[model samples]
Target chain A: MAIHHLESVFFREKVAEALEDQTLRGALQNATGLFRQRRLAATASLSDWEKLRDQARAIKAETLTHLDHYLPEFVAKAESNGIKVHWARDHQEACQVISQLVSEKQARRIVKSKSMTTEEIGLNHVLETDGAEPIETDLGEWIIQLAGETPSHIIVPAIHKTKAQIADLFVDQLSIEPTQDAEELTKAARRILRHHFAQADMGISGVNFAIAETGSILILENEGNARMSTSLPKVHLAVMGLEKILPRLADLEVFLRLLPRSGTGQHLTSYQSILSGPKRNPDQEGPEELHLLILDNGRSAILAEEITRQSLACIRCGACLNACPVYQQIGGHAYGSVYPGPIGAIITPQLAGLSETKNLPYASSLCGACRDVCPVKIDIPEILLHLRAKSVEAHENGKEAKGFRMWAWINRSRFRFVWAHRLARLGGRIFMKNGQPPQWLQRRAPVLGAWAKHRQVPTLAKRSFREIWKKELSRKQP
Target chain B: MTRNEEAKEAILQRVGQALNGGGVRAPRKHPITDQHYAGRPQTDLDLVSSFQEKLESVGGKVIRAQNLEQAFNELWSICQERGIRNLACSDAPSFRDLTDQAPEGLEILDFPHEQAELLEAEAGLSEAQLGIAETGTLVLDGEQENHRLTSLVPPVHIAFLSSKNIVLHLGEALSRAQQARSFPRTLTFITGPSRTADIELTLVVGVHGPRELVVFLLP
Candidate 1:
């Protein structure tokens, strides 16, 4: 398997570039604000929102802990229901399985609904390379795919793009007349994609929740493309991460309530297709064959560490992305991974090794907003801190570790701490002017330069708190 | 072993090892008592009105009818209003009687339709097996009546729902399906017409699915 490294630029450089793009920043701000406000209203409509979160989290915890038991049970039940099941240990195997199925069916034209798992595995590229034309049917995904870019947000893939940008892309790619009206753009996409759906030989989708008890997979979507994709095609393939399993069909009560409200602030999406298998003997519609590919893809490794395992509880609702302050400013593309925001910061590093994605763990300000909005109640900040520690431990002798060690040594005793602070104050007085570190000082201390690049150099207070306490405050208090 | 089997064994082994590892702790049990899974608090409104309100909020329209004849009358007017010359419908026995009453000059293509004909249909009519009030969702069982395409492909989808089938929430509808003798091969819960806010967060209805979802509640 090949490691697909994120974009070449460092995380800070990406942040700088993102901040410079005023249009992208404005789009992200508007989108996140809307999603946040809607999610608040939707959650408030439910009196048992907190209890639902707890129930969802508890279900996820139980399911993940005993996933080894449930996976087989699900496979057994699904097979009994006449759905062929395939297991993939990694992205390479997952892609290979899909490619084989495509070739076996000789499926040339394929239509797909929005699936983050497929994006993570880079499935479209593989299919295209194999001489298959895979069309993304989701409106946002189609827009991004046409622009030759990746999704910027989980739920709303084109969140960072303005309507004008999409209009330009449509004019350039689809050769349609340019229009800024969202309805017109959507109508254009629907007109074009419906043709693909009519001719498509294969359909692919992602599983929202796979019930072990009933051997059914529920796919929730608002656009109804998922239904068309899975229903119209001769062969339907669903790819799911191992963690998508729930023990019983009843568990959907909690998740179905939480996911839509958290993602798009809807009571329910337009369509929830609960499919148990392919079309039955007497059925006149639906796919002739159904294939379910369960991909591990480093999730079991995440499950190894108890704290990190909580990251897998995510349902990919994108609620955390909406609530995250860092994500609001920098946006999803800045993370340079398929998954982004607070959940992405934790997940990307674990799935793709920490070394490749080391900077992602530090992306958050530890404000706990993501945890608060997480439908499954994943302790994302705690997992982020744990990943940061892992990153540091991996590079024990690196500059960051040495800097931390020096700072810790300086604060070992009262005398050393006070003396170090006074020395820093003296340096601050010389090197810092009007809260700006001089260029020479920045060049001389590369660490400080890197830190101050994105932030203002804090000025030491005119009088230290200790000095004020020792001089006048003590006597005044008495 | 073949590659597929090898991968499966490896994955199961890894999962087992991860679960047994010292770092992973046993999950705290949360038994689903009725207290934990109680239905949402009920308001004073009736289920049908609640369903109508919930559905209408999401861009779906609901009509109240005294009987199938009244529902068919409303459907004919809608078809006339939309200038629908051809309509596709499900083949459920109940719908067969409704299709027979199709106004002159209107082509009623029943289920088991050719893909091309279904694609060009101006409107479609189907039957909902259950109605969920909390979300204003209609449950369509594909096996019972071949409605997968009729309710989905057309720009206008009008579904007939018996008032007695309306439930308070999704859980009740799902539980009924679970308790059924044979679960539906495919059950679709539709809350509204297909919509998207993907382009700059602008709400666009009737994207890939029906643009107009009209449900007639038959008493």
Candidate 2:
């Protein structure tokens, strides 16, 4: 099944709509500012922060290049460790495998920890359609699930919501007393989710890092929901993109040091659960069966390109999202992708296809803040430019391509350039009023109308620069 | 071949084709040894003090005890102060003896119980295999302790750590685990109690995990 996007097609319309929301913009500014400050402080504490980034990037490069050699090795080791490894070629097959597991186990109540891979595959929708209930246990995921919306940010999923809005949402969906106290709200979620944990027969989570040598998967979370979901249930299912692999267990040290600091500005998250496999003994308290689903889901296609493959190194830290100016203005929803911000701008076009998510690459101003804060040192802006060129190439007959061609044509010769400039100035003289384009002119030219909707269009100079230089500057100068 | 095997083969083929294609550049060799943290505590005293400060920074309470007996006494007092009647504990050797020496009213329920009973316990107790001073983290090995839920399901968790087991950094702790005969089924590194700031960026402590973590360091 193709990955479902909330709104990548009409990117400009979504961005405009997002710009109109005052509360969302305020929430985003506060959250992003706080994350940026914390990340800075956290990274500064480490003297080897720069060295760690280089090491992490190198490790990811090596592993991704030789992934075929590691995949089977991981599968062999994980299976020997009592984990049943499943492979899926796409999102549809991944969801189908999970649905089959749910039915096979006769699991009705399924608890889920936050996993972006599952979100990309639309797993909850599939499970709900199959008559199985999948409850999101992470505090932010649960809130968005209740709101019938998607995450606005990767790290803080509900960063777009105000406390008042959350309280109202809680009152409406959870039927709790309406209170804006974050503590009380969190308590209510814990109380309810705990009940679900007690009843759940199956649990699902995402993998942060999968070690090939040890056949172990590491899950990092602040809330204990991940632990509960993986432990309380009889069966545990972990979903991951195939790129989330490391060749050796020892390599985790570099990533472990980098991820928390870059993502949340913490030395380490509250909990890091490293599980090699299911319970070794019946007396132990853990899942009886552990299933690991490794999904390609367009990542292989992304890896096929040298320029785009660096995107797979992302740890989903959200530091780039916090640093991105475009993400700050539009928030995550405007991009209409599970992955957003600068990283999303590059990855979405490649994974979802340039035709469907062409506007995503243009979402950034290419300021390179994402690259600066990226733990894996992914050159996000470079990839963004690459994807933009690909988009233009794919749509060669489109108006944007035609406009570029016209621009190049006019600029090829001084005579044509001067004539075009004079023609534009004449039009400006007729249609511009006090340095603003006339409403009629805006209406006549839809592209100009869209461009001028949120901006001031300066009127062309009364006389050409060359004319002014010849007539005034020449007389004044020596 | 089964469908799953065929899928694996197809994925490997794609990966091989992608790598062998001229599109990808040759992979660079990573350094075998990473630079150790320069700021990590160098001495035992520094490690102890740093561990205490780091753990305390994240809202975990640390109590220094002269010995295991003193640590048990501290645990008893904490339970009494909090009005904890039922305390669940792991079957690990360090906590196994607590059931016999529990104070009059405090009932120490060891693991091997039903999951429902564990959920009802007011507090949980477990022993750490190692403590990381740099991040104030506790490393727990599930192979050594049978009850993984003992430290997770309850609202309050009390952990006992030996001062000698404290390491200077995460790399040291991980290296020690790597040197083991085989990796444990589950190894957890916990820095503090469960927390979240997701709702309007408001920091809320104790979401789904224990709200309070109390560690008694034994000499």
Candidate 3:
């Protein structure tokens, strides 16, 4: 299992690879574009969509503020409702607990419903190392698993793989005949997974929301596989983040209105399940033991930062991923972590350590599209700047961030301020002219150089923003 | 300390230092507001009709029945057509009445009642505490053993809803739940079944939930 303490250097290389690959560009652009369109259409029915976003943000903010209270209460309530809850501070321990259960159950085969949390924890690889044959039931996740690749998109894990590629992969992995048609492709994949579904001893999944008031785990999906994974299997293990908690059962109402509209642009998801606990006594079919692994994995660090804390408000609807310009071009693979897109750019750096994954913070156009489409209304561009500061702080112990502090000191003196402006403008022109543009635009990681790649300085017109504003003001004064 | 505990402790310490407190909470400046449902009604009937209208808009069938007996007749007919016999629910009086009205050997159980046990049932019959008309949501409370698991763990869930308990928006239903003064230890607002977009952005339903949800709307 790859204990991916991924470094910034790795992300830079991957981003470079993504830039060079037009095939990946087309796939990402195509998929994100469709998602954006669908999402827009879905939200159109709601007249007060913006207001709804604000409301959702307020609710999340309120929950987080009282999270110290809510978290303990949620834990207690879930336990009361017959949920076996375990707290994992990081991915490795989370995996250990799951594997221990698998060992305890003597499980040889496992099936999974689609969960980004499991992906973040690298659960599949861990299980495989433990000699458990884990099968990804979701079609996209299944493809990525079979291909030995990480998910490139939050919602569409196999967005990089075309239908023909999937057909071929299926033929290779399973002795199934291939067809190019999507329905046929889906049927083929489903046929392969159906047997695994009936045979798997344990199931793993991710929660959409852990309702604190009810201790009900909300999972929304379109396929019957999640049903089977948690239902047919003897034991079900769910991995969730602490941030996924909402205080009341009523909160699901707001999330339901927002999630599908922001994610797939559906007014309502096809299947919504409220899993209270393990299967009841004499129940027809459901998991015997239900265990929830609440993973922290560096989120508390993110929570401590005033700026980046808003990033935690994300619902993982992938709306921001589709809305991000940088993500649309390079795809999820370039990010080199479990999370991808604009959200990943900010989140991955924090989770893996900014010193190690600092390049991720730079992977944005700062177009503010992610913030625009975010259901929970996280101000991503602002968070991006905050993370950039955190990254610099991580590197210089305060020196890398000294540039801003230096500018602040310089700004107090008109002489130093003007001098600095002249120097910066002249430098911008020189770098813009002599550096071959691509050198600056080229990021080793999608999070870096991605902006400069598609944009250029218009040969700084011998003026800065202050100077331009001053001249405009003088003209108006006349 | 275990690896996870160490991580959590590290997070707590790091964040605590940053926030300048042993533990500090992040709070938003303003209250939340919902502006999605335009021209939604304040009247209960409006809420029920609006939600009913939406369910129908999504190619779903929504019919108003006069009583529990009428609802059961319709459900039984559907079950018979589908060859379903076993049923599970979260012990609602209406559902209990329907189960009592059922023929012998029609298996039924209120779900998630016994931890770590499987109820080898085919169909499920459950009653919703409250229904949201705008988004087509069914409210479930866990303090009642029957509410949470009945719809989720079953294959086919026939959600028995009374029209009188329907609300216009999620906010209304939620506010009402809180207004009930003493809150249930666990409240579940189930909008639909368990679903996922993890697979190639394809939406799949019945993932860790009931594949078929048939709402029994009664007067």
Candidate 4:
């Protein structure tokens, strides 16, 4: 439960099942298409949408390149402002720290706002294991918690469920009279949640950004619940990814404009929380203690890589997922990782390594829809190719000694490579009939065949394009 | 140290300045200064309206006007129709103007205290600098009171913005934000109502923030 990788494995299998399920596919397509349209409309309103994307990309890239400098400053400033800070290497450690805080409070019940990091760490499950009940206060998260399902979309978590299904859940779980009406369902959730908020012992949330210049944890939301989550609860725990740090507080003005337009096509979310330590001095109804857990969870590895480090610039706005054509067909679950989109396909492998998430690289169409819509403007398709190459390299290293060992050994030598290329050319000549591709290439080759499984083999001309282009260029130069 | 500090130090333990001349000091690429942002994206205000038109094209309700007064009237009527009181507003001039115009019985609080006092209110109203149609987000800064808590504390939040402020995407806003002399302590770009599907993957609104957001755009 503490590991995103383990959940990823479960997710991959579940998504594969989801893909084959006709009903699920239909629902996913409908919802993703709707969100994509909304995002497109929202982005169109910005006169310089593309330029803005470029700027965001630049800021994140610049900040991350110098994160070592920024993070410490943020900590110093936030600490000076009176906030307690903690570090977690991974979800396991993150959960332990949160549980410790709750236990120290001796608080039996905890109220939670929506936080993806909590999901990343499986904090609720972890809380339960340690004998604390963590109630999800975010309406969508609350529903999923009650039904025991994973979020279907980053922005709209429970996008896959219907009203009737929710009514049944309420009827079964809360013993409420079942009604298929969405309004009635919402009221039921509200009535039950208000009571939990009034008496919650602790509150937990996720941070959208942590300003280094000033001690600030910025959160975006639509519900009033998070305010209550932190205010009503005696203790508040905020968990965030390390990359959520921005250089200064005013920098938020840009992101504030970007995130809402990209994620759910709203002008702004209903709520934005900027917490500056717990109730300073004498305050009426805020958390007595404030804790911020910043998690690395193998992010440094991605940062270390030159090609993949741009992945860190991601704000987790979920725009790429919504804009992605592939994602529209398959939905987030199909990506089979917490990331679940163009960003996930590129990032999961880097964090987990190509060895674990090998299939994620090939999940994209390379149509560049995700890159086109990214608010932070990550070069997602390029990263997808980069990760794909890494995955292929891992496979080609031929970890297992098998039939390909001899072929790889032969291929290692330059002389052999030349001869092999000529021989391959000759074989291509033999296989060609008119313009039709070779029948042997039709089925799929083996390790080489992986590409062929879902791709088309370019028809070999009498001469390779490289040779023709070289000859023409030579003539022109002379 | 706060949770942010201890954790940042631990992470810093792994990040050797090996990349930055082996120095712990961060690169000062640009100091915070106020100037007309050069790289900030500029689009004719008309394009922003097109963005609004597009959102409306896709089944979203949008209001366009010239200033906060018109935006407020539209917002007031919208909330008043719902019989809402106990509203929260960040201490911005636009939001204050709306509060002044609010009906007598409809209570309005100017954001929350550091202790989150105003969070008890039923509704929240705030001023947003711009609306990005791309993510359907409204971007704001915590420079003013209630700038952070006003939009978050109330269940139903109504945000006011001028039509000129509407942008196409988060990136556009960031570009403009870079031009600020000093960025606020925090920036929040909110897209939809606060939501989470943590339980049984059921979509719920207003979990950690406001559930309903109405943006009144004045030209």
Strongest candidate by DockQ: 2
Q: Candidate 4 on A386-407: residue-level lDDT in tens? A: 8777666667655444556877
Q: Write the per-residue lDDT of candidate 3 for residues A219-252, one digit (tens) a residue.
A: 8776656766876778888889888888777666
TM-score of chain B of each: 0.92, 0.92, 0.74, 0.70
Instruction: Provide the lDDT at B121 for model 4.
Output: 77
C-alpha DockQ of every model: 0.70, 0.71, 0.24, 0.20
Q: What lDDT, from 0 to 1, does candidate 4 have?
A: 0.69
Question: Least lDDT summed over 10 consecutive residues: which range in candidate 3 chain A?
Answer: A1-10
Candidate 4: where are CA atoms >4 Å away?
A: A5-15, A396-478, B1-10, B17-27, B31-219
List ranges where model 2 is wrong by over 4 Å.
A468-478, B23-29, B33-45
Tens-place lDDT digits, model 1, residues A1-478:
2224355237778888899999999998888999999999999998888988888888888888888888888989999988989889888889999999999999999999999999988999999999999999999999888888888899999888888888988898889987889998898999999999999999999999999889999999999999999999989999999999998888898888999999999888999999999987744789989999999989998888788888888999999999999999999989988888998898888888887788999999999999999998999999988988888889999998898899899888899899888888898887787788988888998988888987988888767898999998899884
Winning model by TM-score:
2
Q: Quote each prediction's TM-score.
A: 0.95, 0.97, 0.76, 0.72
Q: Clashes per prediction?
A: 0, 1, 47, 93
> Best to worst by TM-score, what's the order?
2, 1, 3, 4
* lDDT of candidate 2 over A161-277, digit per residue (tens): 889989999999889997989999999999999999999999999999999899999999999999999999999999999999888877878888889988888889999999999
Q: Give per-residue lDDT, candidate 4, residue A68.
A: 80
Where does model 1 exceed 4 Å of error? Answer: A1-5, A410-431, A458-478, B23-30, B35-39, B43-45, B97-100
Where does model 2 sit among the CAPRI classes?
Answer: medium
What would the TM-score be for candidate 2 when compared with the true structure?
0.97
- Model 3 segments beyond 4 Å from truth? A1-8, A279-285, A392-478, B1-45, B63-130, B138-165, B172-216
